[model samples]
Target chain A: MAKSGHRTPRTALTCALSLAHGLPIGWCVLPITHFPFLLVSSAYNGCKRIHKEGKVMTFRSLYHTEVINDAGLNGHARVTLGGDFDVLTSSPLQDDPGTNPEQLLGLALATCLNATIEAEEGRRGLEHAAEVKVGVDMGKDTEGYQFFLDCQVRIPQVAEAEAQEILAKCERRCPVAKIVGSSQNVRVHLVKQFAF
Target chain B: MAKSGHRTPRTALTCALSLAHGLPIGWCVLPITHFPFLLVSSAYNGCKRIHKEGKVMTFRSLYHTEVINDAGLNGHARVTLGGDFDVLTSSPLQDDPGTNPEQLLGLALATCLNATIEAEEGRRGLEHAAEVKVGVDMGKDTEGYQFFLDCQVRIPQVAEAEAQEILAKCERRCPVAKIVGSSQNVRVHLVKQFAF
Candidate 1:
């Protein structure tokens, strides 16, 4: 174990060399002292540079789906961060009890939109309750198949103008919204309801 | 209740009028006769045309999320066709138990890929057990945040060449893959593992 008080000119030189050559450096610190080591791998350096520039943090998520039968239409999938979920297809004319891709997109958009609203409220230090409902419709047009999203947000305490402002912010800041909106000209209808 | 064997000129005229002017047609069958009425609305007319042309059937799904707290980060969401699921963000550096946008993307991709593979296999009349694992990584580049997907598909009882062919078909047909891939050049690495 390396001690923090042992960081002399030699230690600084070693750290610099490690960073320069793209190597991993490990440093051990004592209870009373703080020592920083340069585990400057190439990837680590890139991430560090990004962080130093005040960029958004990188996030990774994993998901696995095990097909239960020869028919791939049904499966069980679990996100490393989320619990297990089922995915299946159903006839448009029938009332089925399984999840489909359109539903996933709707769920994703609703949750992400709520998160964006929460983040804005947190920034403004406001305590207002809100609810979001997303309806996704799949249809075929000149561009084969496409989706339309209808998002209804109910804010009980915020005024209509302020709620509109918040929704505008979300439209610009929400990642899922940006991705889906820009892809294939998805028409998004926004309904803002003031319960108060 | 409409009766069958009532295919008179009046019934044909009614059907023609419904199809010509775009109306909602509801068909009913009686104990003694089965009568079909054309309740085809404008949208239903378009769908019927598409179906007559042998196009893919369209699917629609709805989702709702109610934010329980003033903070928008936590919420319960459910899909009309899918089961209930939770969506929440966690610190990027810590291993907290919450689902984020990235995880949802991964799950969606995995499920979509499996469904595509199943469609291809069904077309080819091949029966093989397959499982798919999708890993999505969100990183900041010069253009902001983008996603990278690594899909590992394990297929038993299929030859490598055939499996590759199936995967290629899936890559072309999977809607989620195409959407995410075309959005920002999402790098999708396909790995075929044979567990013989």
Candidate 2:
């Protein structure tokens, strides 16, 4: 693949950032990047496009979240957008009384996969009975410390093949999954019961 | 690149998982993946290879965390390993009173980068004065609903060039940064002050 083959098309990124910062789309001074996939696949408003002519663009985010961490691993992380949430972070190696990266990564994937599966269940008119568990291991590698995420999805009363299909779909559609799955360090398993 | 070029070499992954599960290295039934890089740079003991002769191995995870979610988006995510942590999960698109993928992803990066920067500060004998904030926007794209993460790093009492160097280092060293940064959809910025 050419270096240009994977440059993130800038359309949706520009649109989302502009709308989040309360700037008009046309007012964005960033260099225009024309990636057509971001142009065609976006159903945000199902409209033509974000015109650069200072016309009011219909682009907007379905959800926006902002968070800040000042204390690093031994400090607090709180929600600055969306809702009230805060977590105390500590290094697991120290046995400190707080969460750490491994925990956060696990929760991010577990919640994301289970939630996306729930949405899939809703569309199929099935009651939500799916469970997801993500296990993260932090260890030193040839390079440095790295993480490996092992995901297990369990959907009750569903046949194995169908559950696998749902898990596959969630792997594709869940945003967090899409992010982490891009790495080779992650895996998803279908299980009848969580090892925990 | 051949498809095998990117297959997750299984050395550290296997070692970590095996040690986590209390299984001996020789007893592991999984396929052996010999990624040479994982075989080399790992300073995890600066020792010899993991022999399959049922020998006692020195490999182990520095830290491990497991999390589970049963209720999906409208439920809860809690830690099952290391320390105790739990939080409500809700879809941001619904005005629900809880956390979601966006918040978790933000916290994951914010906490990871800031924590890693703190380590860097300690190494340089500087007081920890680094801060990180991540803003995530969720919108539909040609592919489907996607997330854009804008990371801002602020290092107080440091020159711009030096801080930029640190930020660039953290982008490469931080585990979460490595995972997410591999994608073109993410951007890291060094800023004088956070917009928020």
Candidate 3:
């Protein structure tokens, strides 16, 4: 784990390798035994301590990832920072034993949707029963290839209309959803069960 | 692989488990012993044979995946369909030995950008050497949590201004980039090297 020991907002720690872009500075921490040392600056100046906990805080980023790929889709991708999350990627249509962008996109969407819905379920005093499955299709557009994602969401204990309401709220709340939902190729549907 | 045989356009293949949503039928294939069977329909009827290859083909989805998570971020996530891509997920701020949305998002963006850049380099007859790193930060918003993604691209042997031009084109060609770059929270920058 590359994360510095998380402290209260007043004594918070961040990833020690922020940047040195000669901009306004912020402090991030490196995990050093029981002591976290802050020693980096970054181009991003959006480091706001608005963390609503203590009056002061000093964590610029909660978690950090550094993924490097040389040969693109036909090569290897490894996370150089934090925990090791490495993968070999290829075209989804190939017979290779590696993952493609479609699967990754689908996994991210499904995980994020259900995770966000799980929080909502907890808030409503319900069980964590929401399931999300994203089917990512690689299609071509006017320019080149495009992605068409079909997300089927199932909240078993909830009514259909109410489930739709929850899905809408989660869409607004989920970070991944917010980032990817900006495109017209993505669709979210409420289903009783994912049609496998 | 759940993918059908990738025959020519006249014999194209798709994921056999399309859907039974009672719509205009599209032919998807199940991986058979060198032979594929076409079956299933889906809610999406946009299955166009615009693949511009053979005169005709009969594959709907090139690849398919099913992911399920019951306990959300605190539980396990697994791909139910195709090859298993499973992981334990948790809050990025926690000490648990697992991954979170931030890392997944970074991997997807990094892999897709580098892969797409590789294609561009191949087209330009340049060496396949483009590195991409995405730094995903989780922060709080007025409503809930949000993500700030900082993607740094480095293309060795290419000039900076021309590299930026390549990134702009790749942004249009890469499916993941088109999906996630919609948000204002995502930024794409040209860096000489990742400051690890």
Candidate 4:
């Protein structure tokens, strides 16, 4: 990681100021051309590819969310990114047309895992249709609230053994799965319905 | 916790079968009425409250997501819960209409933290207007991809010191904050706009 050791004193100062002002430390902008000596490594290959396009690449992501009125019970969250996404804290049994944290986590996990699997298939020159279902359970124990995740990946037209191998690789490569699984427990299942 | 040690042989068998079948191990439904000897503790208060409505409660949330095409560049995900959400891997510099994982994590974190704050205020019998903004940064390091979170909370009509006190308590109680903060580094800032 050449980038890890390439932090200049000016960048350190900027980060300190940002922290003091309660701003994002990673939001500090610097012209990449000025640091021509900084070597790109395979670890940051994605970022390096983006930077090679004459663009100053910063991997930082910014997010904004506002809760409407009160919180919990009847309140809703209006999340603004490219559009407004409404999130509700209502239970799934409430017959409400709103989303929850568990749903969002499930979505993130499922999508990331599927993306990894698709990438693996592409690398292997294999084509298959795949779908993922994620189930998240939120509960409390002596250690306070915790999350249990169940992920099932169905890939038709692929051999069951091959699908299992691909899914295992995806589980190891998926970023969201790594994050959540490292922090908590996540169970992954690979199902092959029929062979084409 | 009594429930920790109350796993009956039947429940254990069911869990083993479910695991073998690639089903959710926690989805085993057992009638609570039959387990009168299992003592409820403070750790299970929240679960007990939800279960006291004379309904069998299962804290399971299921989600489905499909990858429309390949992974990474030019790829999109269709996530379906109660509603359909389209997520893209569009860069922030692009004027694209798509949501990303960072935004979703920010929404979940902001909402959960605000809910904890509201609950804390309710317990204290305090009424005040509050708003929270959560900023999450996704980047790569020597340890691979990671997240950095910055949360700023504004509470109106409350003393600065008192609001800080309450916000600190909220930080301690918020589940999402705990999950993320414990895993990574999270910076929390409590800002008081005006003196009331």
Candidate with top lDDT is 2
Candidate 4: tens digits of C-alpha lDDT, residues A65-108:
22232355345765532355555554433444555555556666
Each model's TM-score for chain A is 0.55, 0.69, 0.71, 0.55
Docking class of 3: acceptable
How far is A78's C-alpha from truth in model 3 (Å)? 2.2
Clashing pairs in 3: A19-A41
The TM-score between candidate 3 and the true structure equals 0.74
| lDDT value, residue A66 of candidate 2 | 79
lDDT of 1 by residue, B1-196 (tens): 0111101122333323234434433221122211223222122222211111112222221121121212344434554322343344432323444455555555666666776677667677877466667544444333223434445676555888877777776766676665565543243433454210
For model 1 chain A, give the 10-residue run with minimal summed lDDT. Answer: A1-10
Deviation of model 3 at B181, angstroms: 1.4
CAPRI verdict on model 2? Answer: acceptable
How does the DockQ of candidate 3 come out?
Answer: 0.27
Highest DockQ, which number? Answer: 2
Q: Rank the candidates by DockQ, best first.
A: 2, 3, 4, 1
Model 1, position B149: C-alpha lDDT score: 45
Residue A135 displacement (Å), model 3? 0.7
Report the Cα RMSD per candidate: 14.4, 11.4, 10.9, 13.2
Question: What digit string (tens of lDDT, one per residue) describes model 2 on residues B1-196?
Answer: 0000011233545555455556554122233353323322122432222322222223344555678999888777887665568877776666557778777888998998898889888888889999999877675654346666778899977999999888888777787887777654566778887752
What is the Cα-based lDDT of residue A157 in candidate 3?
93
lDDT of 4 by residue, B44-142 (tens): 311211122222223322221222222442346544334454555443234455555555566666766776777777778877467777544455433
